[model samples]
Target: MHEVKAKGILSAQNGMNIYKGCTHGCIYCDARSTCYQMDHAFEDIAVKVNAPELLEQALRRKRKKCMIGTGAMSDPYLHLEKELCLTRRCLEIIDEYGYGLAIQTKSDMLLRDLDIMKRINQKTKCVVQMTLTTFDERLCQILEPHVCTTSRRIEVLNILREEGIPTIVWMTPILPFINDTEENIRSILSACRKAEVYGIMTFGIGLTLRDGNRQYFYQKLDQHFSGMKERYIKTYGNAYQLPVPRGKELMKLVRQECSDAGIEWRTEKIFEYMHQFEDKEVGRQLTLFD
Candidate 1:
């Protein structure tokens, strides 16, 4: 882990990454793709020591409150977060400024900030987004090693639901000849149903592989799934998008299951919901005055 003073915190779209790179060791991580251009190793974890300060400044400058997003490129609750507390501090600032939060992570460590997130949710919106790729516990361990498994993530979702904090699941990067199966999709959707997630975001029924990430993914495949790398090379042949053969069928299943359960399956609608900010305290204040 390394610390660096960042020039700015929030993006033009209000998204911020408290840390750059990750330690989750997920075999299919796209953040490692060459297109991103990280100066150091992916696991080096560049910590933005000034993130909370910068975020506070940005929030104060906003004429109108809006949702502040994080964890798009790197998990804010990475292992270093436990001690650094940068993510926690940023969350407190967002809560203080009455801005909504849309945070994405696969770590159970997020539960540590439940109090702050609940406060933000009570005042405005706070949505927790988790990614669930493989349903089978063993496979999940192999695919997303070093992070919390799917079952634990599902439990976190259930806890969030009970707390009245909305949640979304990113059921993405379904690896071909690996986790791209109907059973995997159905099982994950079933868990989502039980957790009562607000939405499930999927980019079809397969994962993307580009230059940097593709090489890393293939290396892991050779180590874990013997001969899988050769198969991928033969099947994909340097393609960026590697959609599974049963993508259409599996996607149809996702749409049907999400529709039947009243969960949002449309990617655009889910993004819209996460970006839109709501102030529940305002409604309560009006009601009290009335």
Candidate 2:
């Protein structure tokens, strides 16, 4: 890992990535796409040494309070976080400034900061977003190596739920011919329902393959699912979407399951929920006290 002084921290939408690159080694990670133009190796994380200071300044300067998002391009709680604590420090700043947080991660290490997350939620809002790709533990290990398995993430979700910190699960990138089966989708949705997640975000029952990620994913496919790479190239040559065969049926099932479980499934609505900073209980309590 290397530290760099960054020019800016927060995006126009209050989004920030404290690090560049990820070590989780998700076989289908889009961050590996050459379009991102990273000069260093994907595993060699780039730390924004000034992230905490920059976040404090940015939050203080903002005239309006809004939810700040992180872990879009890279997982904020990567292995480096175990020692660096950059994410934790930033959370302290967010809590101190009474700003909302919408943080995403693959590591259960995020639970270590439950205190700050709870404090921030008490003041503003805090939503934890986690991605569940494969339901089977062994498959999850193969797909998302270097991170917690599906069951562990589900445990984290349940813990967060008990804490009253709303959680959102990103059910995505169901690799075709590998994990795009109805049973896999149903099992993941069942876990989400059991966790009482506030929302489940999925574009469809499929994954995307581009220049950088596709090559790497194909390499893994060859190693694990011999002949799968050839099948992908033959089926989806130079295509981007790479939707599964049962896309329509899978989506219909998801719609029914989520609707029945009271879990938000619409991408736009879920995004709106995550981005919209809620202060309902805080505002109501303040009014009553006043």
lDDT of 2 by residue, 5-74 (tens): 9989999778999999998998999999999999999889999999999999898898767888998899
- Runs of candidate 1 with Cα error greater than 4 angstroms are 283-290
lDDT of 1 by residue, 1-290 (tens): 88999999988888999999999999999999999989999999999999988898888987877888999999999999999999999999998888889999999999999999999998888999999998999999999999999999999999999999999999998999999888899999999999999999997778898889988998999989999999988998999899999999889999999999999999989988888877786662211111
Compute the lDDT of residue 99 as modeled in candidate 1: 84
Q: How high is each candidate's TM-score? A: 0.97, 0.96
